[model samples]
Target: MRAGHLLLSRSSLSHLLLIFTLLSTFTAASFVRSRAPSPQRTAGAASRRDLISDTVENILHPVIHFAPTVLGISINNKGLQLDNGTNPNDPVQVSQALQTQPPPIDLGQLLQDITPNYNTSKTLDSACSAIHTALPNNDYVGRVCTTPECIQSTTHYYNARQAGNRPACVTYPTSSQDVVTIMKLLREYDVTYAIKAVGHSTGYNFTTALGFSSTTGILIDMSKMKAVSYDASTGIARWEPGQSWGELATTMAQYGAQVVGGRLGAVGPGLSFGGGISWYSGQVGFASDTTHAFEIVLADGTFIIATQDNQYSDLWWAAKVGMNSFGIITAVHSRTLPGTTTYGGSVIFPTDKMLDVLGAYANWINGGADKCKKGFVLPAITDFFVESLITRLNIFEFFFDGTDPGECFKDFNIINTLYDDRKVQPYPDFLNKALTNQQFVFSGFNNALYSSVTDLINKDQLLAIYNAWEEYSVQTSGAYLQNTLSFSVITKTGLAASQANGGNAMGVSGGDGYLWVCYAEGSIPAIGALMDTKLFGLTPQAAQAVPKSQRKLPLYANYARLEQKPFLTYGGIELLRQIKKKYDPDNFISSHTTGHDFY
Candidate 1:
């Protein structure tokens, strides 16, 4: 069970060698290997020559001859010796032979020596083999993919940047027990890993394994755990993490109820953990605020239920916007609302109407639209250029909990639009429409996103931010495939609802309304780095354009880029840190897993 004491059997050796060959071939040509030393190996650095010699010595010390019997050769810690008439202890003869003969190679040590910071191929293979052996009869056992084709087949991600990461194995766990088993083995082997729910995350390494030695990583794909159930008596809806919000909505509609969830159908339950925004947020709160409980497996393989009033209540609060820093979530239980038909749809205006659209959005929020607590709107300015043809659009998506929004959306409705598809529709249908229309544009391109919150600004402030964004977009147009700046409001009523339902760790107060701004971009692989570098400055630039009085708000975790520190802006950092320490005392999850870091 220990990594250092691992001894491979003949069958295991063959498996290890096959994995080694595959990984070496896969990475040698396509990926750049990381040479960083592991935490344990960083302290007393050895010279390259000495490290190579020591590796050879370790390999040859545990001599494994192909034949059943040794051929008059004796290997030991000192050196290799030949027992052919010459004295076996003769130093000169042994030294000469050591210089001439090729030393035996220990596949395990060789792998370790090369991959100091990652689990060796032997260790990874052993872990995978153990998983297959432990869960032989489980349906998901067949889904433990190791070959390139199988890994590729199961490795689809919404962001192309994440798709490029190749884990040594991809595991599909159907239940908490399966996840517990995998977590135990991964910890035992000290392997780095990433978890995938729907893979809708934009940040690199957020849902996929990355780095030069990422071939040794493991990806725990939770897609097979899609199971949903409803309790009509209590109006509670329970589901596994594998399903999407769209699927959950459709299924819950059959029960005449719906859970607060993401607006996009393809986005999974992971959104709730990042403080999900939804069409219903204006009436209820964040999607996370509706969570009744969570069934999660900790880094030490302990499976427990986290609820607002349970022994793990702190974990419940942290999990709301924790962003995968605590553990792997298996299941979620949420409060359900009546599944009533809602009025919502998208309206697209021409580029020339940008000011009008901005003014409408500003007026709606600043003019007490949040007071209605039944309407939600997302306004975005998008610029798309293809084949040297540029197109600019002002798109607004409006929603209401009931059939009529009344004067809530009057300003937006009066704008002259290029395309208007507003209508009364079912909640699930509206989500499906948005998904079909919006998710297809950046299908194959690498993407990056940044998020910030500000006080509901006036028309002039919105215009200034828009102008800055437009200038940045035009300056970097040739570097990207598409760019968009979108805004969503977090109403005071919504924040009150969140506080009523066990306040989360997002650090927002109900004193006033605020706006969530998201800047997203997509580019080809060759320009992904350039796009990210430029995109990093966009949020700060826009913040500077607005007055300081209106810009000191928390960043939304779900929409934030990798480098942005949403946790730093949170008001409950000390409590969050204590909860993290109590739950993950050794910091194993944060150290071994790739996710948004809290510290």
Candidate 2:
């Protein structure tokens, strides 16, 4: 996110600038370690030591050198020219060179050579020790743990697949200043790190560090930062990154208010960064759209507040759906609505009624369902594996902003159901119940979600898509413990609400209705790869069933697979890239952390 000036001392600024210059100027090929003896230097040629010294001097001073050309472009009276005599100023040639070029100089080697007593081969234990030394005598030290018990508690992910990662240490920061201190130390020591809020993300490396060679890795646990408050005068709600939807909803209910948040209770505030969809989305838009401001810690360890009409407004726009590419979000302030009584609960039907359920859902949405802005529905064909056999069930979740849904869900009401639990209840109570039920059924399984988006489909298209997913699931039943195919309608009212409130990065419009189709699976580690590969293949086949015009819709980032490039479909790639470059010119976040790839 955008910020004011970097918060670094003069000496640190100079050191960082020197490092940045060296990294930008040289390629890895220039510093490759060789076992062969050095060649004899010709008369008047400089030695390797002399070359390095001269390079450092030239970087510090703003003097241009012609001897050592970069990217085959040399500064002269004739201007920039490539080795092949092509114009280096041409965007096409420059882009081609960037694509074909090798990686930049190694930071570890560069730091070791440039900084006094800086070790390039630091271990996780040593790094944690260093952090402890830096923050000694502070309460934060107690939160920084390297013990197995602490790590296990900090790395408790909703998806079992993510729980296998063992970082060098886990540090829980309870305030923005605490995060700033930890972030500064991590950057100073050149440690790779990942930020974890509630650990609901299913993508590999999305909330954990994958691998660390010579350097160490750390997990910044935000769970201890759980805090929530609401303002009665402004109708605004403020929550820390660690607060879950259920917690936030329950807290807001005390104030007779609510903010658009995750549908599930366990999801953290991080959901807003991925364009969160909530029961209130039909009326207020995505959770990201409801956000009024973000308290962020930039890559350089500087804190800034981003809002719709502020100096950091660009960051405000991008952070809405930019994921974790920008910086760490410490707190979110959002617009709130009155906490009205809600009508919502799950309805379960036997597998035999799948077609009837699908038909009714399609008919409801097609027949002016968008006009009922206060209503939302999600229908899923869920399967449970028990005793070597699978049992399939049709589960439909419905919600209305008020006490009743009126005629909004009449089509689905007529279908015979094996079980029905629809009722009028307080919003917070419904969310807590849903989360309790989900955890009882799906906890402890290695889970992931694969998703795609397309125009709202007809009965035949829905049936075709369901059959394709069901065939694949049955064929690979041995690979997974549970499989579910679910759909969320993105109505015209939702799109309009998003625009009415300052728009987000997801480039959807109210031209036509759409559905975010997701395939969620729970499996063992032994077959996770096979399940992912086969499930990924369903995207193209599902897209083919929809009209060609609506085949390239933006995939929902919250439910997307690691392989899916949701950002590319946002229709604002160039703007996003520019914002990234503006805020993170050194590429510090992308280099030192792992998550969804935005560049």
Candidate 3:
């Protein structure tokens, strides 16, 4: 009985200790809670707790929970009252009692991120109704086939913006008046918009459609506005925006005329703003250099004409490389060359003499030996099958205006025959047989990284650079090295025509530089993965292969990657910023906020 009494006493002491611990915890919690407001008051305590819970919820589910302006919010359970520590009147806050709240999301920022696509069925229905009401009798106004089979007839390319998760829509403008109507609607809705011409741009800012992903915003399809013509007397041609280089080429060929345009035929004018290097660039200059005039539709739904001698010269300069940020170009007037029905083409070389062959060509180009100014000379090195397979290096060349092939061929033969292993075939038969099967050679625009050099490096320097490039090419999949190693005389024809009327942002500010173009060609597989170093599975990955000194931080506008340094590369970001302010102060007109667009 005495032992049992002692056990019972010990149990009572243990229970007392447990109660004491619970009381201490509750007292400490209450003291801390009381410091925020009158936490002793049950209503105040509940309100502070509610504020903390709401703050967390807002962060997690902002779209459904909060209004548009909220940027971000963080809640500190330590102090519940509008902690006077940060800015007050932040609308994102849950209560005046809380110390801090989320900052509001910028309206401009939201517009930049959001790209939405309208349901094709819904947009078609909307288009049909609008077209009928506007122009009842005109068959062309709403002429899209309305049959069940023709349901998804409109071309849609709104994928990238949708992936980034933005509001996007599409409007079909059947006429110039319809374009004005859409402009009015954009103003009324107070939303950002962009125009689409052939949907060719790969960059986030220029293109709206993603082939397999969700679309971001309203696409302004200008396919219906295709118009082209040429005047032989004045050597002038007018082209609408939506036409492809191939289409324009064929059309102009009928008029016995040719254009100095992009190298590939399929490239469109949408983001090939200003102009770009083309196959004919060797002779005439760049595509934009030949542009005589432009008809631009401004932000205010007004049309303005810019020509060689014009009141809106600044617009003309901006139009060359300004992209779609300023306005939509309805038509371009460009200088056209007298058509040549016959042209010279051939491949020159022998595999064993690659070093000598390349060196000879380089010397000729550098020394102006053959007077081959603005002439296209593309070289390719590939495997040749003989008794044993060996490397074959050769050049594919063409002279557009029917220059006598004898002199050029003699020059080529002089170096080639020295090695006693060279052969030459006529231009006509060679191109037909060699290039016949490779029809899709110019189908897509590959990512091309380039650098320019005016200070001619020595043969040793050239050999060193080539060795480094060849090593890089072998290491990386699908990388290629090609060069346009010519002189300034070739590009001197147009005489910096655009410079007289302001100047193109992309036009050569510093003239005469050697252009080295390195490109990666293949199907789009794992672009993001390729960029990330971790995926490469190496101690030093692809990024390390390209040194800071080797890399030209600036990029050529036409072939540049969207993620590449825009301001430093493009050389017009600040100028564009000031222009954006003057033309679009409210920032309602949004492109994908490129590095150039940011500053």
C-alpha lDDT of all candidate models, in order: 0.66, 0.65, 0.41
Q: What TM-score, to 2 decimals, does candidate 1 have? A: 0.77
| Tens digits of per-residue lDDT for model 1, 1-599 | 23233333234654554444333232211111112222111111223212123444344333322211222312211122233453333323332333344332222222222222334466666676777677674322222333443443234454555655445556778889999999999899887777887767776543333521123367677778889999999999889988778888888888988899887776778789888998888877899899999898987999999999999898999999887888999989999888658888877776666678778878777845676688888776665443232245456778888888888888777778766677888888888776223433343355667897788888888887787777776555434545789888888888889999988887778878788888987654334565677777778887876678877788887888656877777887778889999988999987876666677
Count of backbone clashes, every candidate in sequence: 0, 0, 42
**Candidate 1: deviation at residue 129, Å?**
1.6
Provide the lDDT at 33 for model 2.
16
* lDDT digits (tens) for residues 166-232 of candidate 3: 2233344555666666655555444444466654443443343332111323345565667888887
Q: Please give, for residues 1-599, the per-residue lDDT of candidate 2 as tens digits.
A: 00012113335644654544444232211221111221211112222222124556445443333322432322111211234643332323332332343222212222222221211234545656666666563322222233554544443555655554444556678789888888788777777777887677776643332411111367777777878888899999888988678888887888898888888777777788889988888787788999899999988899999999999999999999988888899999999988657999877765666778788888866744687788888776655443233445556778888886788888788888766677999888788765223532343345778788888889899887887777665555434555788888888788888888877777777677688888888654323554677788887887777888877678887888656877887876778889999998988988887655675
> Highest TM-score among the candidates is held by which one?
1
Q: Point out where model 1 deviates above 4 Å.
A: 1-120, 137-154, 205-216, 435-441
Native-vs-model 2 lDDT?
0.65
The TM-score measured for candidate 2 stands at 0.76
Q: What is the lDDT of residue 62 in candidate 3?
A: 25
> Which candidate ranks first by lDDT, i.e. highest?
1
